[model samples]
Target chain A: MDLAVEVENLTKRFGDFVAVNEVSFSVAEGEVFGFLGPNGSGKSTTIRILCGLLSPSSGHARVAGLDVWRDAERIRQRIGYMPQFFSLYDDLTVAENIEFYAGLYQVPPALALARQSELAEVLELGPVLDRLARTLSTGWRQRLALATSILHRPPLLFLDEPTSGVDPLTRRLFWEVIGDLAHEGITVFVTTHVMDEAEHCTRLAMMHYGRLIAEGTPEEMRTEHVQTMVEVQAHPIWPVLQALEKAPEVVEVALFGDAVHAELRCDLNDAEARVERKLQTAGVAYERVVAVTPSMEDVFVSLARRWERPTAAGADR
Target chain B: MGEPAVSAQGLTKCFGAVCACQGIDLTVAPGEIVGLVGPDGAGKTTAFRMLCGILPPDHGTARVAGYDVVTQSEAVKARIGYLPQRFSLHRDLTIDENIQYVAELYTVPRDEWQSRREELLEMTYLAPFRRRLAGRLSGGMRQKLALVCALVHRPEVLFLDEPTTGVDPVSRRDFWKLLHDLPRQGVTMVISTPYMDEAARCNRLAFMYAGQVLATDTPDNLRRQLPGELMQVRCRPQREAREALKRCSAVRSVEVFGDRLHVLFHGTADPMLCERLLADAGVECLEQQPVEPSLEDVFMSLVSEHGLTATATGNGL
Candidate 1:
């Protein structure tokens, strides 16, 4: 595969804090690559390093075949970045915000005008062009932020939690635009807390305490983390969770809304049957009991729990 | 029975001629967990501000625990705990200091401040780090500290505006657990989130769009509103499957989700449609499954319905 982003022993630190520790990963061209982790797990630090905004404490990274550190200025011109919170001038109109970013890219005046018009249409910002950024809704602000980032038509894009506070529909809409960008061969790298969003990425890497713990496609990660999961919705969730916590077949147990999820190493079909039988014997009236599909949440929970496992005896991944 | 914990009637807010909230009516009962969900600029924050008495509505009326928001703003402030989208805690203060400051602001009894402080810190797992400077804390820790401050006074009603937006999935889960535990203590909560899955945790939910409430119900009810069959289409050569499905006349929307495509159709549209399209496209598949609608599905359906109208008004879908 053609590499769009390449990292080798990438390390970053803030004083004694090892923000990113000898992490390395490669993203293919035209792929949606996700960086997944808990807050402060070095996701942002790594992103900043890739975006040429922050220098690594050690090691090397390349974006689109250019060394990130040695060719920082050149690499920056070909990559678009949208931070966790965009720095848009609240007083400026939507059109002005786009114009400012375009000017920063040093586009010719006539071409800039055409680019601005094209972006306005693509992002639905035409009507709101005259409105101040502060007056736009949170979702619109996000759209405007995305529009500004891609205004330069960079070959690569970096978005950190771009859908953080936008509604699901808006998030979906945002992903659609991202899909379009990727289709046009723009390599996209994004960090997000939403697991469902992970499902949209072509490939993903999960970090924990500054280390890349797992890296794979979403489905692959799910398969590696969850052998099987039995889902049950019952009146008494606490008791159900407690009962499953000690089950030999159960690897992890979590509460999903009102439902109790039991992750098992046993076969899914057999585990669901056994779980139902056990609940029945315990006199639990469950609204539903079925084999649960692996989700991004299940994968992360399993990964987090692995560290908490007592006596790493007889453990198999 | 006498009055709902929070109630709004024809509540609207406008900036000059621009309408932010357009006659939105909502009610939250005592101990109820009501989720206010919408994309950005959906006026979720504006509605939250008006209900908390921080921003006066341009028209209509709102009451919190029978206290009129307009006339009894102070009383409303006294009885509610508000955590805005931005953390308002002083960065210079230590975790304990921040909690103490909020306690003092609420006029929490001097003698009880220490105990309340300890309890809040313990519940949020911040006891060991209580003396840490708020500025030095991690993103998740800072969010937790902000939440601890919000709960230190034990207000009868709590308003959290997109409290878990940028935090990682694990922290998001922990924060929501705190929300669930509060209602048991007789504290009603109104939380705004852009996530659809978060809606599942609430006793009731309101989907907002363009300053309007699109639907209000439990997650289960909202999911039932999806108007057709859904299929999770997985196969080898994923891109080929997506391309083929998009051209099929029966498919409504073919969303590429990681290695699979979420293919939605108006109705049954033939179960063999996926296989036929894939075979014709020469795509080899691992598997495909017909699945139930997820919260995101419901969110997408509503947004698509609204987008048709929103686009009609110059926004373009």
Candidate 2:
């Protein structure tokens, strides 16, 4: 299989702080690779290393088969990056922005114009093509930003939470466009806060405190990390939650909709019995307690428990 | 149950020629959470502003905290807490000072707010950061401090407008746990979020689009309302299966979920039919099973039925 991105023992530091610490991962050509981590977890730093925007303090990376140590300039040309917040020209019309990016990316004139029409059609920006971007809503701007980033038809894309604040419908469309690009063999390296969107990635790697903690397909990660989770539905959920919190077998308890999703440290039957006993002791009326497939949210939340929280006295940074 | 914590009927608001929100009917029972779910220009903020008594509705009746939002807006305002999207925590102020300022703004007696402030700070894990200047805090900490300030008055109803849009997964999880604990303390909440997970957390959701509420129901009811059974099929080289599945007449829609396809059938979903199709298409299917429809699945279907376009006219209504 052809590799699109490769990293080995990558590390970056700012004085005493290690931003990306000895991380390693690889993405296959045409794969939708998701990078998952909490804030300050070195996700952006790793992306910068791979995109060749920032030199790694140590170790190595290759983007589009070019070395980051020696071929950053060429790597930049092979990748398109859309950030968490896009800074599109407010004064530029949707079409104007596309045309400008076309020139900036040095796409051939005719090919640029052709891709412009194609992207406009794909993103469904035809009606508002002439409207100034400032007047466009968030969804429109996001689409325009995506269009601009890929105007050069780069084989690889780096999208940082592309659907962060987008409405569900527009967000769905964004993923569809991404899927289409991946199908056409454009490798996508992306980060997202929304868990469902992470499911769109062909494979994923999770980061915590500058270290790669886990890597696999969504299903693999779900089962391996957080075993069968049980969602308990009880009236006056507070008491039930309190009861479950004290239960011995309940590893983690979170509210999933109106239900209390309890991660267990034991077999399903033992855990369920323990949960029932506690709820009964608390006199909470429960609708049901059933084992559930742990969502990516559950897995991530379980994994995100590395909160060696900084106190006022300790927070001298 | 004698009176709803909040209720609205035929809520309409317009800005110039743009009808931001129209003919909306929604109610929040005491101790219940109702979320306004929509994309940009979906008029969630318009309706929210009207409900909060900050913006008057063009044509509507809304009673918040048992007081008319228009005729008795002052009374309503006194009984509610609002955390807008761009909540400003004074950078110069320490976390404690900011909370004190907000308390004074609401004119809560010093004695009344001190305990609540302490409790709020403790719950959000912000107590340790009390002496830290807001400027020195991370984005997540600032957001938590803002929430603590909002809750300083201990209002009966709370309004949070997309409180965690860009907050990281861990912070978001922490923030949501805070939200879940509110109803237990007798505080009803009304929030707006573009995220499906947040939407699911609500007791009821109003899915808004193009300035209208497409559906208002509990997440469970909403999920169950989908007409046909759903199946998740995992296959290698998933794109081929997706294209072939799209051609299958029995399949209503084939949504790509990583390397799996969520096949929503036109009628009763047949797993054998999918396997046969994949077998004929020369695509290898590893696993196939009927699965519960996710909130996104139900929502995407709603958006499709509503005919809301992707561009969605990003007009800031």
Strongest candidate by DockQ: 2
- Residue B255 of model 1 has an lDDT of 67
On TM-score, the candidate that comes out on top is: 2
TM-score of chain A of 1: 0.91
Instruction: Give the C-alpha miss distance for residue B156 in model 2, angstroms.
Output: 2.0
- Give lDDT per model, in order: 0.81, 0.84
- The residue-by-residue lDDT of candidate 2 on B137-254, one tens digit each, is 8767888888888788888999998999877766776677788888888899999998877788888999888788899999889999887989999897777898899998888888
Regions of model 2 farther than 4 Å from truth: A267-269, A306-317, B240-251, B270-283
Clashing pairs in 2: A137-B314
Q: Judge the docking of candidate 1 as incorrect, acceptable, medium or high.
A: acceptable
Candidate 2 achieves a global lDDT of 0.84
**Proportion of the native interface contacts kept in model 1:** 0.51
lDDT, candidate 1, A199-290, per-residue tens: 88889899887888899988799887778887888764555765776777778776685687778878765887899777777666777788
Please report how far candidate 2 places residue B308 from its true position, in Å. Answer: 2.8
